[model samples]
Structures are given as structure tokens and as C-alpha cells.
Target: MPAEEHPMIGVLLNGRTLRGIRRGSTQHEALQLYEHAAARLGCRICYFRLRDISLRRRQVKAIIPDGPVGRYVTRMIPIPSVIHNRAIHLTRRAQARLGRLHHLRYYIYNRHTRYSKWFIHQLLSKHPDIVPHLPETRQATPTAIHQMMERYDTLIIKPSNGSIGRGIMKLFKDGGRWHLQYRTAGMERTLRTRRGKRSKRRIRTRRWAVISFRSKLPAALKRLIRQRRFLVQQHIPLACYMERPFDLRVSVQKGDSGSWQVTGIVGKAAPAKLFLTNVAQGGTVYTLEHLLAANPSLHPERVRAEVERLALLIADHLDRHLPNLADLGLDIGITQLGFPMFIECNCRDLRYSFLEGGLWEEWAAVYYQPISYGQRIWLDRQVTSGTAN
Candidate 1:
């Protein structure tokens, strides 16, 4: 088959320093995996930054790997049939540029926010099957916080647009006193003596701190609410291993069959004394088998089945409402009683978690699955335009 005849797929990234298209060092492995998949599927995969696109020319300068050395060579290629977005956040200018190319299809759509949490909650609250799996979440207000604290012993406060477990706080009532444990940004000062000269060095870090409040919310917590919108959720009592709470990260993606499937599911455990189980926040990932083996009391088969089922349900529901949603990562908390609670859904999930866990095969599947989906989209477009034989 000719190169142009093969379906073209583009991976969109965030970096803008490059003149045309180039893959960052971090994306090297992903580029190789995509190349492997393209060869197997007889498609063309290219990596392009948003700035590399020219709407007037209907072309993009895409980075194509040369050979085994993985040297990237740039070439001006026609706009791809579909784009797989890997950018963390899209700026307004980028969005406008992409909007101009309305003909190009995008697999993964927009980023999900805490407001999306409230929207999903409202949508699923009426469903008996889904409502039980969701925690009570609302826009954080003084009145809402007080009411939620009264109903549940513990409540979680999270930023509306936060990721990687940043800006999350746990508020709980301890007898007559209220306690809050949250991660805060602090600078660590280190004195160094070099070449007979002493110097002071400061490094920024996120440190966890605990505060006690009496009869009222702390002024710090109140100020945070005023600064940004937050989501207040009833904290679920999660199942633990070695006395540290853990949750399941289930990734669901659109497969070649055009259906949502659970691509990878792993247990994420936070370090001792920490509440968030995000891998970025000093958490560790464990395979399902190892996690289940550690907790013999939990039913491995049943929990796995329920997690996959709920993940698919959530994915399908969101796909129906939101167009161009190709994949999502769901943070599900399984209670000690084996009940699963919906934590949050991430649109732009990090693939490194799977890679770090040595699940390279699974990671490759996730990296290439979008390409397969894009081929299908291209075929459908051909048929719609009466060009297919």
C-alpha cells in the first residue's frame, strides 16, 4: 500500500520550543510503540506539537523516527485523519487553532474537572446501580462542609482543577476537636559549604501537615475555599494493606472493536499516614494478584468483575454525553466491606504508571489502541462521503 493510502494518525503534544514537530525525551518509548503498531496495522503514525500545524496549508510538520537509533526526522505531512491528544492543558490560542481544523478527529477530548464530578454525580444519582457506587460530592461551601461533616465522620476537600493528588485535604472530627491533614507547599533550606564558602539553598516541596481546630473551621481552610472552588466529598473507608489505605486505578479505553474495555487495573497504595493514593504523591502500584493476595479477606474474582463492570458503565455513560472521548482513568475506592465507591475520572491519564509497574505490553496496547480507533474513524468518513467501494 502507498504511504498516503494508509490512514494517518497524529499524536498531539504540548511542547512549543521546537521549530516543527519533535518528540520530547519522555515520549520516546511511546513513539516507538506507536511505530510498532503502525507497522503491524499498516498505518502511519506521526507526532506533532500543536504549534507545528498550519491550518491554511492543511498540513503539519510531524516528527518521524529514522531508524533503530530513534533519531527523529521531520517532514511536512498532510493533516491526519485523527489526533490523539497528550497535552496536559490546552491554551486558548491552541484551542482556536484546533477549532479551525474541525475536519480532524480527536480521540481523547477535554480535561475532566471537579465540576465534571458534580455533573457525573447528578447524572448517576438517579440510577440505583450507579448511585450506590458514588460518594456524596458537592461544591465546597461552609454550609455544605458543616452538613457533610455532621453526617460523615470524615470529608475530603479537593481543588476543582487539581491533578496528581495536589491540593487535597482531609477533614475529620476527632471527639470534641476537628483535625485537618493536607499537603502544603513549603521550602526547605539547606546550608552547604563548598570551596570554603557557605551557601544557603532553598528547595520547594509539598509537605503534609496536620492542624487542630476547635468549634469552627480553621481560617486557613476557609481562605482556601474563598481562593478557589473545591469539591467536598464524603470520605469512603477504603480497604487497606499493611494498615495503609489504597485504591484501584482502572483505565478504560476505546478498543479496536469500538467498545470501551478495561485496559489496565492496578492497586495504588499511599505511604503510611498519607490519605491520597496517587502514584505522584508517594504512592506505590501493585498488581491485582499481589494486592488481592495481601488482602486474603477480599474476594479477588468478585472485586475484579465489579470494578470492570462499573468502569465500563461509567465510560459508556460519559461517551454518550461527551463526544470524542476515547479513554479515561477511574479512581475507584473499594471499602473494607468490598463495596466499590467512585472516586474520580481522569481524561488525560499518565501511561507511566503502567510502564513503571513493568506492564510494558499493556502500556503498548494503550498507546496503540487510539490508532486503531482512528483507522476506523477514517473508514467511516470515507463511507460517509461515498468514497468507499
Candidate 2:
């Protein structure tokens, strides 16, 4: 390839981390993480503050588009060979800019689509094989929540566009009482509880603790225009390894053979009794095999094939529904009966961290290349059909 054609992979990160995530005057230890990964792939990462950047056509063209050669030479200007979306927060301006880019291969942790969670679940629901693994879910409204509570006493409320275990609530029956538990910072509190054992009752506050689809949905949609909506799901009894509720994260990547490969399996274990297992929320990570060995009762050997099956199932779903998706970070969990269930999938989730743990070689296959070879075919189709425009 000519010097000018040497695939320019531009990483658009928030400007807050140009030199990497810093504190006051000290560089964060985590900064090295992104830098090392970017160095390995020879990526020219540019951190742009989306709030400062607008979607105005003139501004977008000035910052992103190439010269006249890129504009008129091709009906659809070829996108940069690789666009690493490291954006933490999304604004309308950023979404508009991303929508205008026609020719680049871009990978986002989250998409710019409205009702993204609904779209993702819709695609996942279409897979017959995966249907059994997915927990029964529906849009949460005050009425729907009441209906779900009738069947299953416990329900997990999650912000559709949330990450790292923020804004998650668990409502369930505890002995003689109904309780609503949520997290703020790292500490947890039972914000409200309906009359239970009077002796154990501790704090009584005047704060109104209510979960409503009627109010939250509109506010969430506007507040997180770049993020997806919230989801209310039936809580699954996740398989436990080492006395902690364990969830499996299967990172899948597209291979040169045009098939999906299992990059790595990370078993996320929540600190005892917690309903969620996110690393950001005091969770521990372990290898799939190790966790299985510790929990003989889970009978992972019998379900191993199912894990691989779901990985491929998710890859196909992303390729079909979200045409721009190049890779998927699949969150899967196993119940006490050793039944595999789908938790979530993200397009921008990273795998290099798995590599640091010596999990598997597929980590290199997924993150090292930045863009999947198969996605190029989709890009070509988008250009030819003018859908990417």
C-alpha cells in the first residue's frame, strides 16, 4: 500500500484523555492501558470533546472529511480504514457526525440508534437457539412492572443505556416485606421497604421511592439520546462459583475464514450476595475453566458446547441487524440448572484486557486488527446501495 493509503485508523476519544485519563496532576495507572493497546495497533487516536463538537455539516466536514478528492471523486467518500469510538458520553452533535460518515469502518461501544436496546433485544429474540438463553424481558412501565411482579416476585431494573452497574435496582420480596434496593457510588441502601418484620426495620426516610416507565422513559430518552433506553427483566438465579454469583462474558470476533471465533471467556463474580457482577462494582474476574472446575454442581462440561453455539449466534445477529457492527462483547450467564442465558451485547466493548489476563489468542484476532475483514464487504454493499449515505 502507498504511504498515503496506509490505512489511517483514527481513534476518537474524549479530549479529557489526550495524554490519557489523568487526575488533577497525576497520570492514572489506567492511562497506560489504552496507550499500550493503541501503540500495538499503530492507531492515531484523536480525543474530541463531543459537547464542544457539533453535528453541523460544515463543522463535521471540516474536521472529518478529506479534500475535494474525497468528496467528488466517489459518490460516498471512503471512511477511514478504522474508527475507534472511545467516546464515553454521546451528544446529539456526535451522533449526527457519526451518521454522516459513509465510508469508514467504525466500532462503537454503543450505537447512535434511537431505541437501541429494543432493537438489540429484537434481534436477539429473532434467534431461535438463543431465545431460551435470554431472560424474559419487556419495556418497563408502571403497569408492566405490576404485571411482572405478579408472576416473578423479583425484578431487575437497569438503565438501557447504563454501563458499569450504575443506576441498577433490584425489587423483590424479602421474607414478609417488599424491598427496593439500589446503589449510589459504591455503597448500597434499601431506599424503601414495604412493611416487613418490624424489629429489623432500621431507617425511615421521606424520600419517594418509585419506579415508573411513564416518567423515566421520556427523561432517559432525552438525557441519553446517544445511549439506549432502560430494561426491566426477570432476575435469573446465576450459577455460583466460589460462593459468588458468576456471569460469563464471551468476546466473539470474526475470523479470516468469515466465521466467528471465541476470543475469551471471563467469569465475573460479584462480591457475595450482590445481584450484579460488574468489574466496576467490586466484582472479581476469573477464567471460564477455573470457575467451572470450582463449581462441579454447575456441570459446565455438559453446557460447554452451548457456550460456543451462543457466541456464533450473537455474531450473526450483529452482522445482520446493525450493519456497522464489527465485533460483539456478549454477556452470558448460567443458571443453577446449568442453563446458559444471554445477558447483553456491546459493539464497542474491549478485549485487550482479556489478553493481559492470558485468556486466549482470539483476543488478538478481535482487537488487534481494529476492523473485521467481513465488515468491509458490508461497507462495500452500503456504498453501492447508498444506504451508508
For every model in order, what is the number of clashing pairs?
A: 0, 6
lDDT of 1 by residue, 1-389 (tens): 66677777777766742322343455423556777877778877777777788877868888876666356778897767577776654467766666666544433333221235666667667667788899888899888898898888888999877778989999988877888998777868666676756566666676888999875888888899999988899999999987889898888988678788899887888899888888888898877777777778889999999889999988888777765788787889899878888898877767667776777777888777766776776667666763321
lDDT of 1 at 210: 90
Q: List ranges where model 1 is wrong by over 4 Å.
A: 16-24, 27-29, 103-116, 123-128, 188-193, 196-202, 386-389
Query: Per-model C-alpha lDDT, please?
Result: 0.76, 0.57
TM-score of candidate 2 on Cα atoms, chains taken together: 0.68
For each candidate, give its TM-score against the true structure: 0.90, 0.68
lDDT of model 2 at residue 175?
62
